[model samples]
Target: MPQMSPLNWMSLYILFIFVFLIFNIINYFLFLYSPNQNKNFKKKILFNWKW
Candidate 1:
């Protein structure tokens, strides 16, 4: 059996955090600029009828 070094564990934790942040950033931008979201909103507004 082998024991992991503290430095190695710290590096792995940092890497995981970096990856998680990048994933969230990508998701934010994708959702923020997604044409489909805007399209759906516009369609609803354009087709919504008020009597």
Candidate 2:
């Protein structure tokens, strides 16, 4: 197999990261999140603390 140069590897890494970020951003906005529901979601995530 032909070895990739550092520049090629760097470009591939950056490309994958860029694609991953775009995918996450798309998924984030794909949901219809209202402020009220956002608050409700956060409230549900509260951990029950015990000492």
Candidate 3:
């Protein structure tokens, strides 16, 4: 393996970090999971019965 200078190493690290962040962001949006929502949820009053 060729020896890399400090500047070269820094740039390589930055490049990899950016790539990792971008990949994670893409995956996060791709697999967006939402819990099942009830259509009538808004119609039901939570405080209908007061203790």
**Backbone collisions counted per model:** 0, 0, 0
lDDT of 1 by residue, 1-51 (tens): 236687788999999999999999999988896355454454335655785
* Leading candidate by TM-score: 3
In model 1, the worst 10-residue window by lDDT is 35-44
Task: List all candidate RMSDs to the true structure.
Answer: 7.7, 11.5, 5.6
Best by lDDT: 3
TM-score of each: 0.55, 0.55, 0.57
* Regions of candidate 2 where Cα sits further than 4 Å from its true position: 1-4, 35-51
lDDT of 2 by residue, 1-51 (tens): 347687798999999999999999999999858775444454447677984
For candidate 2, give the lDDT. 0.83
Q: Which has the higher lDDT value, candidate number 2 or candidate number 3?
A: 3
Error of 2 at 35 (Å): 8.0
For each candidate, the alpha-carbon lDDT, in order, equals 0.80, 0.83, 0.88
